[model samples]
Target: MIKKIKKLKKIRLHREGTDTLVYGFIVIAAIALLLWRFIDSKVPFWCFTAIMGTVYCIVINFFRCPIRFFPEEDTTGLVVAPADGRVVVIEEVDEDVYFHERRIMVSIFMSLFNVHANWFPVDGKVKTVAHHDGNFHKAWLPKASEENEHADVVITTPEGTDILCRQIAGAVARRIVTYAKQGEDCYIDEHLGFIKFGSRVDVYLPLGTEICIKMGQLTTGNGTIIAKLK
Candidate 1:
């Protein structure tokens, strides 16, 4: 019974848009079958039905829905990675837009196949939530971190630590979702929002914080510790 429950949970994850290729193939196959049946048979009624069904499946699978989650656990001091992707950059940079100071910037680049969920990196009260309208460059491009359409979330921990997380839209990703708003109490590893399709997540940590992961490392949402405040 225990093993069965675990299997069920795994099935749920796979069904929730995580296996995008499998779902895409299924949709394409259904559309092909419908087209063959109606267009070849000269069934006018079936042709209309098939066209609608094909369009519905394409829209629903591509943009209407996405899979997101956050592990329910106490995550304080430790910085949780906000998205599943490869760590592209981890360096000290001057943040002029929001924090107005130097910080350790950790950027994760998500491909089309990655889980797009974004999670809070620390338990804190949201201090600010800002969205900027900008260009949609390739997500992995270095300049995309600052110039791309994105949403910024700043959280102030009980200990007075300031943590910042950003959801950046790529050339293929046009939507950025953020659930954390100013003054809301956000727990670490809690579900904050999501980014549709390929994108990137940038986490800015205050100076003096020790980073746990290195450049080129792969991280999962709420599972990989990006850093810890000293």
Candidate 2:
């Protein structure tokens, strides 16, 4: 039991290698500014310290990685939340890219304060992964899902149901990192990707599937059950 708990608690740094480079540059620049302020004494020490401190706090929080536990029983029909955010959209829409049919689109808009780590919504094998280059529109906008830069990952369950999840880049979010590879088997609640800064994620479910969440509701990634497959 102890070992099982330990394994569940294991955490991973999403985009750690890239993040390290960013952190190193930010810290070094801040320190250099502080040193310069100290030597010159032209600007008030407190003001400089406060400004740099706030910047570091926000940057650190943006890259935070939290542990997520999977459901204890089999997750065949369970659809978990893929990202931490508030439900922004819940409607039936025509999905042209992958499905070429109508699907129920559930979108979660993430703020800077929310965890940016993404998780797989169900147990499945990745069918395809595609990335698009586009404008940086605000993620909460309905058009962002189709217009903004994003990555789409389609997963097929053992029962042969197709689920499509997309990671979208917001005005402040410039990067979308996806870990999904075609033909790779993925588990529910497992790490899927990360979006730098604030963004959103869209999940396309087949019509007639039970929707468990409502509009404007907040969701905790991997912890909140979004829906159930038929």
Candidate 2 deviant stretches above 4 angstroms: 1-6, 10-13, 17-43
Candidate 1 regions exceeding 4 Å error are: 1-30, 38-74
Top candidate by lDDT? 2
Model 1 steric clash pairs: none
Pairs of colliding residues, candidate 2: none
Candidate 2 lDDT tens digits, 1-230: 01122246445445643565477667767776777766766455556667766866666676778887864566768899999999999999999988999999999999998879999998889999999999999999999999999999999987899999999999999988899999888887577999988999999999999999999999989889999999
So what's the TM-score on candidate 1?
0.75
Shift in Å, residue 46, candidate 2: 2.0
lDDT of each: 0.77, 0.86
**Residue 90's lDDT in candidate 2:** 98
RMSD of 1: 7.0
lDDT score, residue 83, model 1? Answer: 79
